[model samples]
Target chain A: MTSPVLTVENLAKRFPTGRSGVFVNAVNGVDLTIAPGETLGMVGESGSGKSTIGRAVLRLTEPTEGKIIFDGRDITKIPEGQMRPLRRDMQMVFQDPWSALNPRMRIGDLIAEPMKLHLGLSKSERENKTVDLANRVHLRPEFLRRHSSDLSGGQLQRVCIARAIATNPKLIVLDEPTSSLDLSVRAEILDLLNEIREQTHAAMLFISHDLGTVKLISDRIVVLYLGSVVESARTDELFSNPAHPYSQSLLSAHLPADPAAKLERHVLKGEIPSPINLPSGCTFRTRCPVAKDFCEHEVPKPHHIGSAEHQANCLRIPDGGNRIAQTETA
Target chain B: MSLLEVENLRTHFISRDIDNQIRVAKALNDVSFRLEAGKVLGFVGETGAGKSLTAQSICGLLRPPARIVGGSVLFDGQDLIEMPQEELNALRGDQIAMVVQNPRTSLDPLTRIGDQLVRIHQAHTGGPVTASRGRALDMMQAVGIPDPANRSNAWPHELSGGMAQRVLIAMALMNNPKLLIADEPTTGLDVTVQAQILDLMKGLTERFGMAMIIITHDLGIVAHYSDEIAVMFAGTIVESGPVREVFAKPDHPYTRSLIASTPEKLQIGGGAKLGGQPPDLYNLPSGCPLRTRCTFAEDVCATPPTRKQIGGGHYSVCHFSGALPEGGGPQ
Candidate 1:
């Protein structure tokens, strides 16, 4: 088998509340991998540890445990000083364009900063590259001189993309890149991201709460719940036949354009429990429709379903649910 | 009579420079719309598409440097644009309230959540603080906020993003306003929370027999919730109609493109493509602002077009009003 570009195993992160309270386990044992040129999507609700996992992979926040192997190198325990060079290969695009950027810096310098820092380019070379990156993202070169405050939300996002791509990174973690943008501009940004991937063959860890967008861009999908990977499969397979009860509920809640599609809106009775005070067994057992008494005693392991490539963290799949019938039916 | 009528509403920002540039954005250029007592009008458009401006104008909250240049804002048989400042202020929270997108920014960071709620109620209804607090607590409960009494005293930062937005809605409904302007209230919210908030807004609007102006860029959202929808492009209402009629058959090129671009409608992996950047508002094109990006632009488009009625309560401002391409061709 070909080696994956980025690999993560049982990754976890915990933050000290510092108030004598229990520590907050932001990310709890998430295992994922992305091959070269693959767009892997991580979908979850707020406080589901999706962003925490992304940060852990980048080593931005210190991880409490687990392994992060990037391109044959185990980077989990690497010092911050040595990790600087590795950052050149892995870049991140933040969600909020407004706060992510420095308002005082001009757009040209913002995009050029990455080039100057990592690429060792001269002044004129950096300027030319900045304009080139802007053009790629459909931002006019003339606007590079403008400050972040002057540009609108869509323009600022384009500038953010230009900065992320400036370093020619192999894997870019897109953290809700288009969520803040309006629909018309969002389509444009999605197109630009696809174009960049096609042109550069760079992998992407596309994290978003938007299912529609994830289904469009991601080759494969990972469903997270309360800090655990409940399911992972090919995008089409996962959307068509979601195995986990939480996945089913999430998909059912999505409002499709067609009014005739009978989507049973399952309103989970209780609110999502705090990450600090997670339920004893199966993290999703609280909300899962098919959760049983045994589910409360034992955490579900990743049971292989559909094909060897597909897996789901649900005991119901193995307990006479007819996994073959459900997985193949879609 | 229509419950609300806005005629030739134009909000312009006066330039601070000595040149007296008078940067008249014409945010609402001769825009006209009517809403009945219990109708939901959805304003669907991209950023700087004048949807926000139109909402803020209706609320009479356009900040300094930006003022109503020429228009008549009639609400419930009263002309709001010409009303005195104090009278308008009284009518604002009493008759018209807005639920903004970011509750954190809209809410006062310094004040306790409960205190802010009480203040809005007292200012609008002139009620006692204790009585207002009781009402505020009830309102918060109605919006599905858990433990309203305890949570009310919590600071804005203590609440999650979804919880903060619910608080904003609670404040907006303090006086049971006749019209509620929800300006992308669920834009930043998660889908599940978004669905909950949207349901709450819809239920509250119906329960109070209030007219709602839901400003959003998501077509699916507008289609699901709005009875009427107005598609804006470059400070102009290109198309306005009943939501079903507009979605079934969009007349304006921009509106058609906007609807087609929605991912849910398109085949998977074949998302609709909208070309290039949105035109700069400062240096707008000669005639149709969308001509640059529009696929069916003609010489007549540069001559400007006017709204033409296509059906029941449906209007499109296009030279090719009924001549829009089938299945969104070429654009």
Candidate 2:
């Protein structure tokens, strides 16, 4: 394939808290890379720091440590004034459509604003391209005449996609873009994203909490626990045989749509420890059933599960003791 | 007899638009269903399909600008709609309880969890303060709240999200109600926590022998936990049947589209026609609400269709129920 469009190495980010020395430590040493047209899926629960990684990759939020190299250049600490030109090649779409969109602006202008600023097109030229962009996202041109208030959640998301691609960016970070929408509308949006991915060949970092939806679009999947990467593998590999115990519990917890699907559930017992006071060694040790005394004293790094693409972080991986028994049948 | 029966339930929103024109949004039209004692019925639909409105209407929770223009809600041989406000008020908190989406907002922040539970019980069936407090502790333990003796004193703000939801369920069960309606009870919850809460709800319903109506947009929840399923569209129950029958052989066009949209069943780029935007409430089309997006629409669709019963108590409102191809018609 072509050279990777984005490479993030050992990225770490910490947000300051009210107290003097303590920090949220949202993202801790995340490593990821996306090929020119590949999609990387990041799945984690609240405070797992998946969203922070997305923002850090785009440099929307300044990072505390690690390197971010995009398209052959290191952009970990690029100055905001000089980063303006680079904005044309990177874009992001957030979860809530109502807040992401400008309610005061007309739909046509909202879609055209990005192109108008980035491409510097004339009035008629931008109008022609706006209509074309709307058509590309399967939005009818008539709806463009209305404001954001008149559109439904699905329609508003389409407008956001149209704006994101109007610049023809090399990378796009989508953070739970479809989580707020209904099921049918989510399918339609996923279809639209697949179509655009083929046409533009933009590398995408898809971050969401729903594993089922993430499996639909991502080529590779990364499992996170308490702001740290626990497992990374190919889409099918990760779903079929996840190595980490946290990943195992998450997959078994999902309820399949078919009523006849048998459930082997492993409901974790205690609550996730607050992010402010993460566990000392392996952050997941407190809740992990298979954890032993050694797990609390030593941190585990990435160990190969099968190949270069499949890896997980666990002390038990070396001893082949990471498997946790499915506890109950529902 | 069905524990709860809602027949021809019609609710409309009549309000003056900014232009001062009288407009009526037909929010709920001809919604009817039945629930057996100790059985769970799951409601699945899009955002504006009136799933929650049906629950609110049955409990007499409608406010101004929204009125129950037609129909009756029969619970335990009494019509909830025709009853007086005083009688309904007594029946509501005593016999029927509702748990809404946001657990934090639904709970009172200033009150301790134990006091709130005891107060609800005392309001319905008056007893000595110590007796009510004992009952509160029993319910907290039953709902899987760990260390019920100590956690009872924690206020709403002190409890975690999942813990708060458990307290809400315990409150609903305090009065030994005949029916419980939980609207999107676990929507904002984490997946692992969601499993724990759903399991607790199912266990409690069976133990108490009380009927339940679970209103949610997630089909997975309905498929796994519910005994029956009702698929709603455009403020109407387009299909209702045993969960197995409906999922295996969905008859209505709208139901077929919805089931196919689930991530487990859906094949991306399969070209399955998933076209549906909930109809314009103010001016819904005259005939079939789904005809606009239905690929099999014909001249006959201009006229309304009645409910057609397939085998095993499965019902569908379509002219050609069970006539579509496997992947749906004419995508």
Candidate 3:
């Protein structure tokens, strides 16, 4: 197998709650991998540690324990001072474009910041490159002179895209890239992201709560539940035949835009379990409709059901290998 | 008669310039709708489309710089526009209740949840404070707030955003008003929380047999929860009809654009794209507001679109009503 662009093993991150005696494990034992030019859709509800995983992978958050191998090098323990050079190969498009960009910085300076730090381009070269990157992402070149505040949500998001791709990063993490945009603008932004991915062939870790958008863009998907991977499968196969109950329920909640499409909507009873004190047996057992008594008693280990590529952390598959056979036949 | 009738409502704002010249926004230009008891009306529009402003105008909550210069807002048998100050005050909270967006800002950060709930009941019904607390607890329980007693005592900051929203819902339900206008209650909420809140609101509305107006920009939400859907643009109801009918055959160009633009789960490739930002209300183009970005614009589109009924109570505000392009290719 061609070495994965980025591989994370047993990653965990903890944050000290202010004055509170307890600490929050934002990410817990997350293991993920991204192939070159591939899109991995990471989905979960809010506070599900999906974003924490992204931050941990980028070394934005100090992971308590993990092995992070990027481009065949272990960088988990790399000093913060030395990690700046690594940023050229990895960029992140934040969820909130309005707050992410500095208000005082003009669009040109904002896009040029990465180039100046990484490439050390001259004044005129940097200006030309900034304008070139702006046009590449569908942002008006003239808007480069304007401050971040003056731009609309769609425009600001474009500027963000320009900034992320400005350094020609090999991998880009888009965190809820289109949630803040309006409908038309959202479609435009999605189109632009797809276009950029095709043109630059950059690997993407698309993180979002919107399952529909994720399925549209991702080649594969990783479903997270309470800071752990519940299921991972090819996007098309997963959406077509969701093996995990949590994935099925999430798919059901999404109302397809087409009125003719029939969706068997399932309302997951009860809120998501708090990560600080997650339920022991199966993390999703609390809300899983098909959960068995054994599910609530012991933690279910990951098992390959049908194919090695598609696996789920569920115990009901039965022993003697008949579980996979029965499930596939049914 | 319709429970509430808003006829040609027009809200304009004074410019921020030193001249203080009247910069007419026309936030709700001739926008009209009614809320029958036990029915839900959903408003879908892009930001700055004036759906929220229309809701505010209905409840007499539009603040300075925004004044309703035209139209009559009739509530039940009385005209709310011409209502006496004392009568309007009584009607504001008791008869018509509004759940404002961003519960955090609307909620009092320093006050306990129970205290705020009691205050709402007190202000509206002037009930006994002790009884109000009990009622507040019951309200919280009804809205699916777990551990109502302790949660009631908790400050707004102590609760998560979702919990704060439930508290807001409890306070809104305190008065048991005939009409409830929720203005984008789930804008910043997680999908799960959004679903839960909507479910709670639907259950409460059903139990009380109350009418509700849900103003939102999410097309999927309106498609699922609303009985009737209203597509608002530049402060006007561009399209309004039964949700099923409108979703099946959207007549207006703007409505078609919206239905086309919304993303679908099944679509693998590029979906519908409407170019350009919505027009500025203050400096709107002379004719159809959407003409600047519309693909089917003509010289006649320079004239304002007219409302045409397309059978089964479906109305479309488009100059070329009959020949607008049909939305296709996966939502």
DockQ of each: 0.37, 0.79, 0.42
Cα deviation at A99, candidate 2, in Å, is: 1.6
DockQ of 2: 0.79
The lDDT leader among the candidates is: 2
Please list the C-alpha lDDT of all candidates, in the order they appear: 0.84, 0.91, 0.83
Q: Model 2, B1-331: lDDT tens per residue?
A: 7899999999999999999999999999999999999999999999889999999899989997999999988999899999999999888767998888899998999999999999999988997989999999999999889899899999899988889899999999999988999999999889999999999989888988988999999999999999999999999999999999899988888888888889997778778556657789999988898898888788888899899898687999998877777656522
Q: Which ten residues in a row have the lowest lDDT in candidate 2 chain B?
A: B322-331
Ranking by TM-score: 2, 3, 1
Q: Higher TM-score: candidate 2 or 3?
A: 2
**Relative to the true interface, what fraction of contacts does candidate 2 keep?**
0.74
Higher-TM-score candidate of 1 and 2: 2
DockQ score of candidate 3? 0.42
Give lDDT tens digits, candidate 2, residues A1-330: 677989989999889998999998898888888999899999998989999999988888998999999998899887988788888899999999899988999999999999888899999999999999999998999988999999989999999999999999999999999999999989999989999999999999999999999999999999998889999999999989999999999998899899999887878887778888878889899988789999988888999988789999999998888999866675
The candidate maximizing DockQ is 2
Instruction: Order candidates by lDDT, high to low.
Output: 2, 1, 3
Model 2 has how many clashing residue pairs?
Answer: 0
Candidate 3 backbone collisions, by pair: B287-B302
Residue-wise C-alpha lDDT for candidate 3, range B178-200, written one tens digit per residue: 89999998877777668778878
Candidate 1 lDDT by residue in tens digits, B1-331: 7889999788776665568555645556677898998899999888777899998888778898778888798999899888889999998877888888888998889999999989989898985789999999999998999999899999998888889999999998888888989998998777767877887888888788989999987776787777899988888888999877887887888877676667765443254466656677667788888888877888987977887999998999988888765666433
2 against 3, candidate with superior DockQ: 2
